[model samples]
Structures are given as structure tokens and as C-alpha cells.
Target: MKPAKDWHAAPLPADEAKRLRQLRSLALLDTPQEEVFDRVTRVAAELLQAPIALVSLVDEHRQWFKSRVGLDVCETARDVSFCAHAVHSESLLLVEDAHADARFAGNPLVTGAPHIRFYAGVPLRSSGGLVLGTLCAIDTRPRKLTPAKQAALCDLAATVEREIVQREAARETLEVQEVERRKLRVSESRFHTIFQRTPTGKAIVGLDGRFVEVNPKLCEITGYSADELMHMTFQEITVGADLPADLELVAELLDGRRTTYSFEKRYRRRDGGTVWIDLSVALIHDDEGKPMHFVSTMQDISGRKHSEEVLRGYRQELERRVLERTRELTSSRTALQTITDNLPVLIAHVDADLRYRFNNQVYRDVFGVEPSSLHGTTVRETIGAAAFEHCLPYFARVLAGERVAHEGIVYEGAPNRMWNATYVPEFQRGEVAGFYIMSQDITETKQRENQMRSEVMLDALTGLPNRRALAEQLALSIDAARDAEVPFALFFMDLDGFKNVNDQHGHDAGDALLRQVAARLKKTTRADDLVCRLAGDEFVLLARGITSTSACSRIAQDICRAIARPFEVGQSEARLGTSVGIAMCAGGTQTSAEAILAEADRAMYEAKRKGRNGFRFASLLAEVAPAINNLVDRGSATRH
Candidate 1:
């Protein structure tokens, strides 16, 4: 068992004393409860479902209740006052269960007297951002509030605030009448009011530079209390180097030489840190025109100074990088010249007007023009008019930011040899400035176009078409399917248990297993179907003339059964299943090879998730676009 908390007044806000002054100035203390206030509390008590409601004013030693309903007391000591704690909060202080909160548990209010179990209050504030008191609700039982109820309570609190502001305005009107008799007194009061509430740091400095008066904003900027500043002179906290210039300005102001002065300087904080401030000062004269005080205003500019320094560093670093890039480009131009000259190719830089900028050394041997002399010469002069006509179409493409590659007898010059030319666009700030040409004499290679290059397209282990050949075949098949008004299906397959076969039997057996799987796939598909080995144990099949999904499923089922048969490898037996994903492509559909490959790969993983040795459609795991879904049959495009 723990003893009850004897004292829980809570820590006060920095403006607590000023708030107390404002609360007392309202002149509502110890007054009889009025209908204006009781009417609001009556609404809050009923709307919040609380037993008691009060418009509580917190004084120096106690919370005095101006308006109350469902409660007997008019006042409670500050030590046991919930409104006293609520006054420190900027907004509502809601305690669902006072008995469960460590700060309020076992307090006198919960253990005796009102026996408060639930408490909620909204801190009433002044125009100067000071919390004066709270409009509170009290309950004898532990309870909770919905967001709607809490909002309703805030609306009720706003009514109480409007009533308080009206009373304060009336009191100010009376005080203004009394101060109007003395003009200087009214001016001084207004000055004090602005000095306390202004966001900028301000102070009244004595002529002798000794301690005078500092506002809360100044104290906040210098990280010092008003008491600490009052005991010290301005010179005590100013940076030593800045003191001389500041004193010169202050002297001129007093001697009627300068009316005001403004400058940027450093001020030393109490914590031994320096802060940059934009300081502006003006002379204040009292009655009879005698210079009285210097009113100094300061704004913290440390953040601006930091950002300027960072921007300067970034600018210098960018300049250095630009210089480095220039040197690298110079070296690369020299290296590219040497490399292009060694190859049997005519390389040149041509401007947008079709005139040459420069040419490689090979141009001298091929075109009978010196590399430097080729500059300023038109392509019609070097390669003849017929070649320039052929080059016009390529120029349009490269200038439009497309790289063009073609090989034919376009340049019908003296030798009349076929040339394979690639035009690469040069860009300056995202615009096509010009282009560089790399033309190789591939006249011999074109003669062997009809030859079958088995080394490039055939798989060495499986004797099937590899990925390079598969790409060419797939493109042809897609065009054929679109022209013939038929469809094609792509099957992406992956071995499931093949890793075990490789680990237990070794790489030799794994190679043999893949070769056997490829042969099985070839035997399982139709004569028109193309079985291609993509990479490792993964294979792809392109079956054109596919009109229905059932036909594709039949082919996948046959391949899966063939691969599941037992294999013989180095006197050891191993088995692995296959997962197939089919990507259905209907006729006249504009589908990219990459999109189809990705779709099939994702569906293959879905098939793996459905216990292996199974096949799934890409549409089962991915959403097909409306255009593509409309092209294919519903059975092939049904989303899972």
C-alpha cells in the first residue's frame, strides 16, 4: 500500500505569473455565479455526461470556481486542484481514469472530498498565448469520452473563452479611461504591452550600457532570465570584437549624430555559445527632448548564415566537378581517335547541316581524302549524291534521338562496297546537337547471311535453340500469329527438385539431366511448337496457332509427365518436377517480349506454390489489362 500524494500543484508555465495577473484583472473572482456562465456549464455537464462542470480560475494559491453545477464548493487549494494542473496545458487535459494515472492516483481529490475519478479540462488562453485557467468537467465515476464528445466539450469551452474575453475588454476600457488623463502614462503602458508580446527580441538599454530592462523574447533569444540580464551590462555578453563597433553607434545616437543604426553581429550566450543576430537600434527621447534610452530589436539570423555557407560550398564543388569532366572528355576524344583509326572503319563527326566536322585516318585510305581535309566537305562530295539520299532518312532518325543501324550498298561510290553504318546522336543539354558515324565495311559478312550459324544459336549440351535464337523465332511467330488471325502461347518452365539431383549426383549428372529434359520437352510438344533452352534448367516453348487455352494446357501436361520419369545418371537415379507458367497472346495484340517474359515468370512461381509438377496461367496471379483481357478468351484471362 502506498501513501497518498500530499502535494501535486505541477510545474507552472513561464507566463504563469502574468496569466494570474490577467485572471485577476478580469474581476470575476469571488463573484456570484451568473447565468451567462452557468448556462455554458449546464450544457457541458449534460453533453459530456459528467456530474459536475465549472469555469475555474487559477490564482496564486487556489482554484476559485466562478461558475459551477452539480458541485458544492466555490474554491479548492492549489495543491489539490485539477484545474491548476490543467492551466499549464495548452489545450484539453483529459484523464479517462484519475485512479489509474500515476500523477493523480491517491491524491486528496480522488481519496476524499469530491472523490473525483474522471477529469477533463480545456485550458483557457489569452490573446498573448498565455493559459489563464481552464473550463473543466468532473465525474464521480471512472469513465471515457468519444472523439465526438471531446469535440462538443471544446465547443463549450470556446463559449466560456468568449465570455472571458468580453469581461477583459470591459476592464481594459475602464483602465484606458483612467490612463487617458496622463498621456505619458498611457504611452508607457502601451509600450510595455507590445514589449511583452512581440515575437522579436527587444530591450531597453540604459545610456551608460548598464543593466536596464529585457523582455521575455530577448531572454529567450540570449538563453538568459530577466533577473540574470538585469544584473549584467550589455558589454558583458557581447562578443569582444563586436563591442567597439556597437559602442560607436550608441555614442553617435546619444550625441545627436545618428538617429538609428542597424548591423549584423555576434552575441555571446550564457552557455558560452555565439549566435548571429540582425540588430537594429533607435534612440528613445523622454519629455523635454532629452535622450533617455536605446530601444534595440534583434532577430536571430543564424539559420540563414548557415544556409549561405552551405550554398557557397556546393557551388565550389560543382565548379570543380565541371572542370574534371572537361579534362576527361578531352582525354576520351584522343583515345577514341586512336582506337577508331586502328579499326578498318570510316568514322566521322557530321554536323546537322550534313557537312563533316572531322574524320578518322581510315577515311584517307577509303575516300582519298585526308582526315583534316575532310572537314567542311559535304557527304555528297565524299560518298556521291546517291549515298547522301540514302543517308538523309538515317539523319532524320538520329537527329530525332534514335540510334540507326543498317547495312547495304547505300554508298554507291567508286568501290561500291556494302557498308554497315551506325549513326549515334550527340546531345547537348537534351537537344540533338549533331551525330557521330561508325561505318564498317561488312561486304563479306552480308554474303553469308543465308548460312546457319549453329555455334551462336544452338545449345551445346541440349542441342536445342538457345535464348538468342528463341528471341528471333518468337518475333517471327508473333507476326505470323497476328497476320494469320491466330494466337500464340509462351510457356516459362523451371525445374522444382533439380537442385537435389545436382547436389546428390554431381554437376555431370545435372548436365545430363537437363539434356534429357530438353529432349523430353521436344518430344512432348507439337511439330509446330519450338522448344528453347533459356538458361540452366529453365526452358521456354513458343507454340503458335494456339486458339484455345485447353490446347496449351494439354501440351504443358504432356511435358510435365515426360520430365517426371526416372533418370539414369552415373549408376545413380534422381528425379525433379517442373513448374510451368503460360502467357497467352491473342492475335493482333501489341505485347512486348519483356512483358510476356515477366508475366510468365511470375505465374511460374505461382505454379510452384501450388505444390510443383503443376501449370498455371499468368492471368491467375496477375491482373490482365482491359485491352489485353478483351483480346483473349475469358478462360485464359480470368483473374484469380
Candidate 2:
């Protein structure tokens, strides 16, 4: 608490430059007072029983107060500033009485209003180790701070230093967030422009024909705000005369009978006005082919309907014009080129003759040809004969007025990826015309699913096959023995002294020991053998084509010896043993995995009962029991 010996407050001009730079970098000068800094000053004043306390920063030409308890002035000239001397000092500046000190004996601050007599200031350093300013206590009457009070004042200064540095870091974070907001604004602007392009109403509808998202354009067409529309379904606002046909098409889209279908419909708006709109609807699906939502665009078509009514009075003159419009309808289908071309999925239409009629941009990206250039090409010619023949049957089904959604087809054109596709039959005048083909690449989804399945079969602690994997292999082995009359052996093993090792050293060390044992077991077994951990300290090995008594017995001995070796556990070595029991099967009529496993388990305990590290054979097949007995009689019992 007392100032260190030989330490004096001497203002160095060279150090002042770096100190002032660090002070300004905090951006705390000439600002309103903050409560974090004010709280510390208040505590310093109360604990010391002083009249004035401040968190003062030394600027280039002035000493500014960031937080002041009783001081009236916010700043003072640097030459007359008492805190300026503490800004470059490694230790605090403690002046018992400014009037008695030779440095400030005749200073103006000692003779003027609000005169200073006692000053104790501690340097607040930046994280870069440059002193910025001081947390000071002042009184008009001469006094001295006790050792405990000096220590308390230093602790308060440390609090102010922490707040200074953290505020600077927070400012940097705000700058980063501002930049991210600017980028987000630009993205939103682009979306707004596209959303308002040509559609009078745009929305994302749920499977139940309820609005999930409605753009402002839709809100304008209907007299309801976006929030009010959310609670109401599209069917509720539709004119009842047009409701049945609209519901029918929606059903067809949901049932996979069509990828997309558009029709003119009338809506009963909020004011009870009938507004006709050309509504284009398409269903969106997840990676598993489940419907997620529907994206719909509605364009005002009240004028078109009025024109149709007038044209019906001049039927002969309108015949040629009607044929031209029919051609456009057959080509553009709802004029959805803007939407379909932007979609990530591959979409195309084919005629009854299997000739490609239309395709979106994704088709060109996949096939390496312009979609327009491929318009007149047959499906077989564009996809090549091999892929064409594979899809021919599905095309026949679609052309027969059936909808098909397939996920198992391995398209030769993209052999490295999986695909999900929907074929929707396009009908004209009660006959099948062609179909719309929509496909999406689903390689990543399938890969993730396969990874999850593999993790389930693996032991997370040891990276060995787990009990589930062992059960699968055991089933296969039993079926092979029963049907093909082949023979196999199952080894039931439990590590000796493993529990004692865990109890003495801890579970973490036991896990380390188990991983080492698993590595050794894998090395000892043959490549065709299956090694897996059942649960804590219990393991199973399925060794195929090892039915001979001597072969199976030697295999068990090798496994026992492998596990008997000392394992390096943490900083120490742990010694453990194994008790192994072998169940040999050679195509007996009563051979079963459960019966063999139980017999092997009993034999394993028998080996443990005889001594810890040893192997015993329980030949479950009646044909092999006699040979196994002879081997036992030949003094072939192994014990380590």
C-alpha cells in the first residue's frame, strides 16, 4: 500500500506521447460520464472519507474527468493538472499536501478557488501496458491515506481499467454488426424487387391451403393486413362458385398427380368484391419427398375474362385469334418461366411422342446443351439409349395417365449421385398427352443418413463394432450354418481384473486400457473373423470356417495371450487377463445362436473358475464333440 522506495513521480516527455495515444484510443475523453466509472469513484470517496474523487484522463493538452464524485470542473490545463504526473508513472502519485510539496508549493491550484491540498492518484493502464490516466482522491484539507485505504483505492482503479478496455472491444463488435446489417439490407432489396415484378398477389401456402407467407402485393389485392390473412385459409376467401374446381386441382397436386397446375379463380375480397386472378400453384417438397409448403403467384385476370365475354359475341372473327392464344397456352402453360427458371430443381415437359417440348435452365446446366436447342429432340436421343431404356417403363406409366414418384433410380448420366423424381401426366381432352418431369439431386441427404446408421453400429469409446453389429453378424453366421451346412465358431471373452483396474485407477484409465485391448484383439484375429465389444469388458468374436477342434482351440489361445499383455494406462502400466470360451458349430439340427452363446458363456466362467487367463471349448455341434473331447484329453488346456 505504501509507495515503493526510490519510486518518484517524474513526468517523462517521451513516454507521454505513447500514454496520450493510448488514452485517446479509448475514445473516453470529452464524453458524458458513465455509471461504471462513476461507481468506482463513489466507492473510493466513501471508503477514504474524501470530498472529491474522479476518474481523470490525460488528454494531449488537458486533464478531463470521465467520472467525478464532487468536482465541479470537467477539465483543466495539463501543465496545472495533478493527475498528469501519474499518467506516465509506474506507481501512484501520493502528495500529502500540494501546498507543502516543492513541485506544487506555489501552483495556482493551491491558491485558487476549489483549491487542492491532498491528492492521491493511481495510474490506470491500458491492456497494452501504457498508463492512460488516474483514479484520484482529493480533499481541501491536508491529510494522508492509510495503508489499507491506499490498497482499496488501487483496487478501485483496476475496476475502471477493466471497463475502459471492455468498452473498446464492444465498440469493435458493434462495427462488425453494422457491416453485416448493410449486407442483409442489400439482399432484402433484391428480394423486394423480384417479389413485386409482375404479380398482383404472391404467397406461400401450406398443404391445407392456408397462407404461410403473403407479400405486400397480396395484401393490397385483398383488403386484409398480412397478420389477419395468416389466421384465414385461401378457401375461406375464394368465391364458392370457383371453390370446387380449385379444391380439386389442389388435391391432385398434393397426391402427386401433377407437379404444377394453374387455373383462373375468383376471390371474395374483404369488401365482398369478386376479383378474378390467374393463380399459378406449385408444391414444394423436402428431401424425403414430403410436402413442405406451396409457392403460388396470382396475377390479376379480370380484364382478360371481360375480353373473353365480348369476343364470344363475334365467334367467327375470333376463331383465328383463339387458335393463336391456344398455341401460347400450350407452350407457356401459366407463363411461369420466371419462377421455374430460377428454381434449383430440374424441370422439363415431354410430348406424347417422347419429344422434349420445354425445359428450364437447370436442364442446360446438367446436360451441357442449351435447353431451347433440345426442344425438338426425343427423350432417348437427349439422354442416350442406355438411360432412355431405363426410363422407358416409367414414361409408359405416366403416359397411361398415372403419377409416379421414384427415388431408387440410378441414372447412368449422373452415376455418382442419387435422385428423387416425380412424373406427372399431362392430360388433354380426356386423353394422356405427355408428362412433366421434376428431379432433384439428393446425394448429400443419403450420405448423411448412411453416416448416422454407421455410427449406431460402432462403439464410441473404442471404435470397435458394438453389440448391435455383433448380433447382425451372429444371425448371418447361424443362417449360413443352417442352410449351407458350413461351420463357424463364436468366442465369448471377458477381461479378468478389468473391474479392479477401473476401481483403482478410474474409469478414464479403464477406457484407455479397453481401446488398447481392442487394437490388440483386432491384430490377433484373422481378416475374415468379426470382432466386436458386447458391453463393458465383454467381447464376442465370430470366426467363420474354423470348425476343426485344433484350429478353433489355437485361435482361442492366441486371443487369450493377446489380451494378457500389460497395457499402458495413463502414466502407469496395468496388467489384465482374459477368460475365453469357444462355441464350435458344424451344422447340427439344433444349432441356435442363443443356445451356443449360453454354452460359451458358461464355459467362459469355467475358465475363470479354474484360474483367470485361460481358454475352454464347448463344441455345440454333436459331430464335433468327440474330436473336441480328444483334444481336451491330449493335455491342451491353456493357462497364462
Count of steric clashes across candidates, in order: 0, 0
lDDT of the structure predicted as candidate 2: 0.77
How big is the positional error of residue 81 in model 1, measured in Å on the Cα after superposition?
A: 1.2
**Residue 154 displacement (Å), model 2:** 84
Q: Rate the local accuracy (lDDT) of all candidates.
A: 0.77, 0.77
Regions of model 2 farther than 4 Å from truth? 1-329, 333-338, 352-355, 376-393, 483-487, 545-547, 585-592, 610-612, 629-640
User: Which residue pairs in model 1 clash with each other?
Assistant: none
lDDT of 1 by residue, 1-640 (tens): 6677644557775666688788878888888889998998899898888889999888888888888988898898887788878875645799888888877877798988788999999977654435677888999999988877876787788788777777777888888787887877765676589678798898888887765777888888889998898888888888999999989888887886655678888889988898888898877776466878878888898897787678557544543443344335545867656666776667777888778986778888887768888789887788877887877898899989997865674564446578877777878899987887777776666555434566669888899999967877776666565667577899999997787788778898899889889888888888878899999889999988786666877887787788888887888677778988889888876554655777888777656643467777886324643333233322332421
Model 1 lDDT at residue 550: 68
